[model samples]
Target: MSAFARSFLKKSLLAASTLLLGMPALAEEAASASLSNPFICRRPSGAAGTITEFPLPTEESSPTSITVGPDLNLWFTQTGTGTIGRMTRDGAVTEFPLPTEYSIPQKITPGFDGNLWFTQLGVNQVGRITPKGVVTEFPLPSAGSSPYGIAAGLDGNLWFTQVTGNRIGRITPAGVVTEFPLPTPEAQPTAIALGAGGKLWFTEVRGNKVGAIATDGTLTEYTVPTANAGPSSITLGWDGAMWFTEQFAGKIGRIGADGTITEYALPDANSGPVDITVGPDGALWFVELRGNRVGRITVSGALTEYDVPTAGSQPAGIVFAPPGFLCVDPHLWFTERGSNQLGRIRAVTVP
Candidate 1:
């Protein structure tokens, strides 16, 4: 095996062993309270056409995925720190360390039971954190599942994708886990999103297909038009279609409920598009990891790009903070994995 592949395997095995053996508590006190004051950077012009960056207290936090909690706070996973973090709209940041070391938390989502559910890829478990900061964990039945993406399902449960295990899993509010195997072997399912008509849509990064699984466990797969397009993330679009990012092919794709697929190539070649979501302004927004830009794609396939202020930021996740308790208008929240910061793009104009 190549040296790079060997090193990756060694790290994966070490992480799994750490999760299996467990580790001493690192920051038990921080779990129930906020951390130190955050380093907030706000633009002078206020929310209109402004971008803010908030640095996490812990260095190399490596925030991977973010979701708006039910309490209107931003909840995200710190992959490098092995902790779950919460940040208020005003920039108060709190971190809750996971019980298992090297769990490598990935995507986080608000559960229907008034808590946040996240994937622990290294430990092969799913974690739950309450609004008040209490945490609980549930283990998957299969080892080495490597759960990546998670979202609240229409049936009052949480659905997630197992990239290594090549399956879709559902966990109830009570923490019962049931996994469904994918039709194609080794598809490496990555991100998942709840679709219209009470179904869950997901991406098969290795199989180059988009899949739909009913709440009842019925599965259907649709092949992307491009070969090895590397569909990485999937989201529900404003126009009632399922939209996704093609990371390797540098394109955005749309699939109808009836299985018709359409592809739109990005303006920049080799952009490495990753996560995508529907913005509050009725347009689709995404992150370009390689291109160092955030993107907007209209329902009609019109694409526009906005550059991140930090060079080589490697933005990974994007979500919209709707107008509510702390926000006067909707703002886009993203994670700068390369820069170790939380970023916001506010008052964006849709073309």
Candidate 2:
């Protein structure tokens, strides 16, 4: 862990112990908690009673993203090691070295054609990997592009952010690439997800806006009401609005398809929300990299926070993994950037 994280953990542990000691009768009420340095949590569908933590190869290598691969295994990106890792439902782990040869792989997502697509933030290249672990890479058309986040587009292609290039890129399943520049320079688009409306939605970390692009590479930008909000990750919500995290401003934002934007403040002023996803339970779940918590924002904009066992752990990525009753496994899987551990949170029915 970073020195900052180590110190924060110490303080958090002290606080947790005090919280426990101060209420002797609360022992039975303490939720079951597990993590070497647990970072993020998700509750997979149908598997409501079990939680699983998938450890990384190292204690300091940050795993950045996780998604259910077409092969039915979980695929994640290791930003610290510049590798892609695969962990099967039965707990088998395999890894593939990144092809960029210069930069770390930042984000990863499932492509339309059943391959895993990822971005190389340091080298400006996009990569593809198959269920069998075959990897292919395509160099960005622009120099210093610094591709960050990626997601499958409705057009049977992969769309990604060129954070430094100030553009978004589209790559067909066959690996052909096309680039579209944003109207403003240095937008630093960070994360992207295919919107319900068949368009690609993304966050501009520097530009402080949520933008969209059609399959034809047309660009549209919507400014957030707050300044330096640092909008980071964007995802389609169950409610038909696009939900995003404002990393610096400590709020969640929603954008209508017509280009209107609304912001909701988190309970904490510095949650530093990074990535978000719509859960099966119909809540908007996101990682709080700074506040050290899992944030749940309801469709109606109600905010709830859950503290991870480890503090300052820097949860970065999240995904749902529902195991049936026969397997006895179900929960959400997430990654911790500061602790180099996987986090799992189970859903509890409200009393």
Best by TM-score: 1
> Model 2: which residue pairs collide?
42-332, 43-332, 44-331
Error of 1 at 31 (Å): 35
How many clashes in each structure? 0, 3
Distance (Å) between predicted and true CA of 102, model 1?
Answer: 0.3
lDDT of 2 by residue, 55-168 (tens): 677656688898876554678888888788888765667888876665688889876576788988887789999888899988877898888989887677899998888888
**Stretch of 10 with least lDDT, candidate 1:** 35-44
Segments in model 1 whose C-alpha atoms lie over 4 Å from true places: 1-49, 325-328, 347-351
| Candidate 1 lDDT, 64-118, residue by residue in tens | 8988776668899999999999988567899999999999999998766778899
Task: At residue 282, give the lDDT of candidate 2.
Answer: 62
**Model 2 lDDT on a 0 to 1 scale:** 0.76
User: How displaced is residue 298 in candidate 1, in Å?
Assistant: 0.7
Cα shift from native, residue 16, model 1 (Å) = 40
What's the lDDT for residue 243 in model 2? Answer: 95
| Candidates' C-alpha lDDT | 0.83, 0.76
